[model samples]
Target: MDVQSETVPRDARHRVERTRARARYDRDTVHAILDAGMLAHVAFSVGGQPFVIPMLYARDGKTIVLHGSIASRLMDELADGVPACIGVTHLDGLVLARSHFDHSVNYRSVVVFGRARAVLDADEKASALSRFVDALIPGRAAESRAADRTELAATQVLRLAIEDASAKIRSGGVKDNPADLALPYWAGVVPMRTRYAMPQPEADLADAALPASVRRLLAADEAAA
Candidate 1:
């Protein structure tokens, strides 16, 4: 399969109809959004019923990896090769406009289209799970113990290739009407961000030192802040 970053053919399926100017197809731009995101809302239909569920995901080259309990119906359906739409979003700020109709939000979001397949091979599934753990926090997979046979057997890992995708982004100041500028109402952007608080340890492990992976994550979060 062709990598989404290499070529994302734009058609009615993945087009941004509302605001065409905000649609972006560049490789770096699309990959950057995926890399920054940790959670994705996956939408798929079973029979005639539709479902949208939030799941933790990891971007692995051209595919997104997700795992769940083996007995979960959602996981079973997705593993059966159902067509899925995954969405990831990061809210940059709240756009406040003088007029309520013009109020909007500044965000970076991506919509991906693909069919999911179950990772049945033991080694492949384990590798995918490891990559997922590391994606959340770099080096975490190495710091933690590997899953045992029983644990691995109870989990279902699925991979969705990025067959077609597109990113829509809105940034900068609030877009308010020129006439509304002189109004008494305040119109500006209230910036928003996700930051990590001080780490909390388990009650039994109160004296344990912070792991290398956690220290690195804290340092990165602090630098970004």
Candidate 2:
């Protein structure tokens, strides 16, 4: 929501661009896709070698913040304003078509290009780190103790000022050759979703408070699926 509509890059694509509706221009749609994803792939180059590392992240309005140990190689370099390409994707289903060529996956993805900066302030870094934890475990942060000085020193946080970004989404059922419609083989989408099971209380725990935030996440996470 922090990104202004005008600040986004041109929505036009090259000749090789995929389906037109596959492209998303609205900011809210892009943010929603990003929010649904729990992880992001950070792509960058060093000494001309391109690399992409998948890591956990949290979005605070406009900026995408990544937290890692100070000793982490990529995070350290990224804090130095390294040019980076970041991608986040969510796979929604598997489309099964009669022909192998028609098989595809339904997904939503976003690619962002920006300059990275290290979070220097103790307060800002701490807050960003908290958001990262909450994104994954909702009430986990509230249930735990705050980071101490030593912990803060050992942590490295980086923020990417997303200047140019684009989101592409693919959904619905399979696309097949018009002539192949007569084929008898089934053709449809196998929907994929994240679900949850009943809470399994920890063995060592007794009477306890299961925070509402955690309860919601427990219901949303379909790890068994």
Tell me, by TM-score, which candidate is best.
1
Give per-model TM-scores.
0.95, 0.87
TM-score of decoy 2: 0.87
The segments of candidate 2 whose C-alpha lies over 4 angstroms from its true place after superposition are: 1-3, 11-16, 197-203, 206-209, 220-225
lDDT of each: 0.88, 0.79
lDDT (Cα, tens digit) per residue for candidate 1, span 1-225: 233445566677887788987888766777789999889999999998999999999999888999999999999999898899999999999999999989999999998889999998888888988998998898999988888778889989999988888889999998888888899998889989888888899998789999999999899989987
Report per-prediction Cα RMSD to one decimal: 1.4, 3.2
Error of 1 at 63 (Å): 0.5
Candidate 1 has which clashing residue pairs, if any?
A: none
lDDT of 2 by residue, 146-172 (tens): 788788889998888766667788888
Worst 10 residues of 2 by lDDT: 7-16
